[model samples]
Target: MAGDDEFDRWISPIEMTLNTLTNKKVRGNSIVDIPEHLKKSNMKAYKPKVVSIGPLHRKSSRELLYMKEIKWQCMLSLLHRLNPTDDQKVVPPKRLKDCGEVILKYDEAVRACYMDPIELDRHELAQIMLVDGCFLLELLLITNDKQLNGEPKSKFPVKVSKREEFLSDLKLLENQIPLFIIDLLYLKLFGQKSEGIPNIINGYALYLFGCSSGRPIISPNRAHLLELTHWFLTSRQIEAKPDQERSAPETVVELTIDPPDHEHMESMDIWLRERDERDKKVSKETTPKLERCAARLQAAGVKIKTFYGKNRSSSKLEKDPVSVMFGCKEKFEQGVLEIQSLCITEETELQWRNFIAWEQTRSAEKTWEQTGTPATEKKFSQYALLFKGLVCCEYDIELLKSAKVLKVHDENKWSNEKVNKFIHDIAEGIQIDASADPKFCEMINDLNSCDKGCCRFIMFKHCCRILLTKARKFCRYLYRLLMRDYCSTPWQTLGVMAAVLLLFLTIAQTVLAAIAL
Candidate 1:
């Protein structure tokens, strides 16, 4: 009997952790036909030179919670898109896809992006849980100050100090994110595998714990959790343990602010008041110092020229909306960024590079089919050169058209010579056309050589947050042009047809993905 209790207590934390992570409780079936519409339409883009989009929203408290519920509920959700499930904890992005072998490689490289250099066996589940929890707490504190009557919530659902409550919530959030990851791993290794994510991790330990009145499945180990959490929040560049030699540190969510609005401002106040850790060195009434900080924005506002980085060497600004708000009104800017470190090992990096190469190969093949294959002796330009020539991220709305072209060519059999020609054509087209388009020339006239890449990236980036600030600025003009050319078939030809093709392609891609797995 003593042995039974001892054993039950032994694995309770581990079992509960698995259960929470494996919990899938959300479902959303919104049929967004944009992808389908896009593929069917014989899309010819009158690609706008510089379209602005932001300020983009990061995970807000409500949004994060909602995301958690979604992940807990939705069984079909992808691993990379776990923001909602883990209460807005960011996941490492997969570097590449569109090919099985390539994807496997990228999966390795990108996963390494999550390693913690300070720990041994950095891949161990408990260690990841600590950092994951800390990251969630940090995002909440950074995004907005949520004070419930100037207080925070606790994860254990037990009463505690304000700081403790915040810490508890953060821990719960962290546990929620990686709990499933570990469970799924264990289940796949030990449990009976059917297909996809298992219905339950059927390990003997889990089953025994469950059968023993479930008490052993949920015993809390505060001391252990606290020690792990401390290392996560404050550990410096400590080398990883022997087992975690290649592991990276956990990424705390990078919280960006948008232009300030009444609601946003209010939310910020609440978040900060509730989550701020009380320091003995500082007074309890430490009003948030906002003079240096940007403001939170409302919807339909203008994006600012401001860019916030967690550290140096970060991406450029042009993501927030406070500039328009400030220019138009006395609005503040606020945005959130979640920077989750990946488990980037040498192996992982190799995988990503290979995956990227495979993608290039596919794109090249497609170009060849579009035209004719190049001779073996022909030396041609790399399409990556085009990426270097253009601005990156989502700043360029016009480039979506180019991306569409590339997407069309991806996996297709195209001639290298044709691709080389196409590259020249696009470049020549831009060179000749830039001089002709008054707006294009005027917009870039003052920009120096170095600034030129920014211009191209801005022109080519999609209507994503990184580029949306500009895309928003330009999308209206684009929409206006689309409407004016209503009589023209750009929309009709591309829109309807693209939608149909997208559906077919989606089905095809799903099948291919299954085979790869």
Candidate 2:
């Protein structure tokens, strides 16, 4: 009976959990805390700097307290903007109460979006969402308005650096409110029938991030700002066609010739088998492994080139950032490796690290059965790995720079070495499986083959050139030595020439005597 009681106690919790899971609303947890392994390497990348937006970092530090007043002011300004004709200068109490109520209504859904549980009560969580959502909306609106008017004005008293930092803080993985909270509040502010809320928010976001407005609007179902930005940056339009239409018809050929006898046929079969073995051996030798750095690739006849859009007028941001191609109709002796131009700046590390963090979080939550490996899904990581492989040293950075593939903003502050280290550090601690991306694997194989085809030739040519240069230097040194030691004056120069001529004459005479004998 005691054993039965123990088993029942253990089973009861599992049964209760199952019931809760089945009965509760289905919501995906999108906002996740950065894993300790990733955070340990670069905590600043994941943590918010200028302001804390959500409950996760509400109490992270006292420094965020100053932003609390700013949030309240932004919420009030947004409220005023909604009801501009109000007689009272101050925001009405009822309007503020309505915003809080709306946030409170979706409190449970908002909490479910985060991976970790919120310790704050319903009212506290609602207040955080209400204020933070308003602050973000107001900031976007202010920035958009300023840019549209062609004026450098500040609605808020924040400095340019602080404002930029605040913008960067909005992209942090942990510092995000649910996107629906913003949508809900925006709906409440403008009447419920206003269907353009998503367009408005997405447009403001695109404008704020300096992305082309022509980019497709992200579906409103995105989890947060970071995910929207991720989609905005990495998404591309792919033409879908039926497999039969896309694939070419297979071709087959049959060659027939009569053999003189069974013995001749056997001999032909033996020769064919030997030829097959030799071809396989040669293929194995021709295809080498991926080179470590871009300099080595350049040396092996791989031309590194930057890919702008198909047209010169198209915005670079309009093109997919992760796309890479290697084109060479002939042997790798002259192949062009094309990659989208990457601009590295001071905020690049912070922005990209958070993007990587979001990708890592999403990949962890989703199952690979739906998609393929994380490599195809986590494209930003693949792009980072591409640059990491290409930029291992200062010379590799210079090679990329000369190719116009990598642009470093403010070269005085961000040097080639800094960019090289930044590329190496961006994708640090992310584990990419061997079979992650098939296209990437194919590119690597092609690069290896190209390297194999021209590496030996490049090395031999380099060696020959070095030998020729050394021979020339030795001759110059000998001439200088003869000039200094024996040809200081005209008499000495004539005497040295006479001596050289006499030696040649003696050798000729000796050769003639031997021939006569």
Where model 1 places Cα greater than 4 Å from the true spot, the runs are 1-62, 73-113, 116-382, 387-517
Alpha-carbon TM-score of each model against the true structure: 0.16, 0.66
- lDDT at 213 for candidate 2? 43
Worst 10 residues of 2 by lDDT: 322-331
Candidate 2, residues 463-512, lDDT tens digits: the string is: 56547756766999999999999999999999999999999999999999
In angstroms, how far off is 509's CA in candidate 2?
A: 57
- Per residue, candidate 1 scores C-alpha lDDT tens digits across 402-476 of 322122123254333233333333222111112112332232222211121123343233234545655664898
Best by lDDT: 2
How far residue 319's Cα lies from its native spot in candidate 1, in Å, is 32
lDDT at 66 for candidate 1?
A: 35
lDDT against the true structure, per candidate, is 0.26, 0.64
Candidate with top TM-score is 2
RMSD of each: 28.0, 19.2
**How much lDDT does candidate 2 score?**
0.64
